[model samples]
Target: MAISTIGFDADDTLWQNETFFRLTEQRFAELLSEHGEHQVISARLLEAERRNLAFYGYGVKGFTLSMIETAVEVTNGQVSASVIGEILSFGRQMLQNPVEALPHAEETLAALSGRYNIVLITKGDLFDQERKLAQSGLGAYFNAVEIVSDKSADTYARIFSRHGDGPERAVMVGNSLKSDVVPAIRAGSWGVYVPHELTWVLEHEDAPEGDPRFRRIESLAELPALIAQMT
Candidate 1:
């Protein structure tokens, strides 16, 4: 069956995401190491994030607060104010820095625009996602931009409904194995996995082996030919 609608994931799928976080984390590790083991700070932050998902969701703002909270906890309120200032500065840079789209992201998206209904399915803080979209300059290619709190089977189903395509007529393309593939497949859509150079550890999962409806491509530039073959 030919695909009528395509859902694309944001962040690492189109523009760099994890790299910023990774760089920030390294800075964070350096500062926390001054107190004791870096792992202690890492563990505390993860625990706080797990606890704060409902309260904070995704973005630099929440992440910065989580880092600050973890630092205070790990240091028993002895973490230096200077270190906190550095983390805050890092977060500000991440937010304000302009982002460049991944290789072939713009071109492929342009090619796919008129041929198929394209939608951006992203999960993150609304403001941050919007800021990135505005900066990306690829927003015009998308028929819709969805800022979902989570990517679940139900979320895909709902989005499919709104797009006027049933799961059978839609395809999902993204970097994350968990968010972009699993839920999409569960909702009965075709899923295409385009692995990014750096995937978040939390988003890592096993792909469905030999699934006829699932296709994995190495890069976005390969998508047009793949879609042509599928159609």
Candidate 2:
């Protein structure tokens, strides 16, 4: 089927996202250095993030909370107020961080926008995602924007159906195999994996080895040609 709609993931796929998270995590390890080894602190923090996903979903606020929780845990509930405050500061800085569009992000969007129904489908804190989109200066290219809580097969099915011809004629491009590729391919859309240098560990998964609908590209600059080939 000819592709009509293209779905894009907003975080590391479009702009620098996980880099900031990784930097903040390093800061977190430094903050809790007195309580535990950096590796242990990071592991516990990841655990907290995984455990709290149901309550906090995804984004900087949840990350901040997880860091706090980890600090408290590592310190045996004796984490200083000063350290907690510093962790909160880290989240604030992340929220305020400039949204740097990945290379070819705007160019690829521009190339596809008029030719296809371009939809931004991403999951994160609603306000933060909105902020980044507004800051990106590439928002004008999208025909629609979906700030979803999560990306599952059903989520893609509903969004693609609502926004375009549906999953059979849709393509979802992103950095995560777990959230962006696997589920999207399962939903019957072509899943294009554009690996970013610093994807979150939670978002890692093996690619579908034998799926014809699955494609991989090293950068967004190649997306336009890839789509052309698909068509």
Considering every candidate listed, which one attains the maximal TM-score? 2
Candidate 2 — number of clashing residue pairs? Answer: 0
**Candidate 1: residue 136 Cα off by (Å):** 0.8
User: Against the unseen true structure, what C-alpha lDDT does each candidate score?
Assistant: 0.87, 0.95
lDDT, residue 86, model 1: 88
- Report how far residue 46 has shifted in candidate 1, in Å: 2.9
The residue pairs that clash in candidate 1, if any, are none
The C-alpha stretches of model 1 lying farther than 4 A from their native spots are none
Q: What is the TM-score of each candidate against the true structure?
A: 0.94, 0.99
Question: Residue 195 of model 2: what lDDT?
Answer: 92
Give one digit per residue, the lDDT tens place, for model 1 in 1-231: 678999999999999898898788777878888776667667777787777778888778888888898888888988888988988998898898788899999999989898888999999889889999999999999998899998998999889779846777888999998999989999989889999888866788999867888899999999989988888
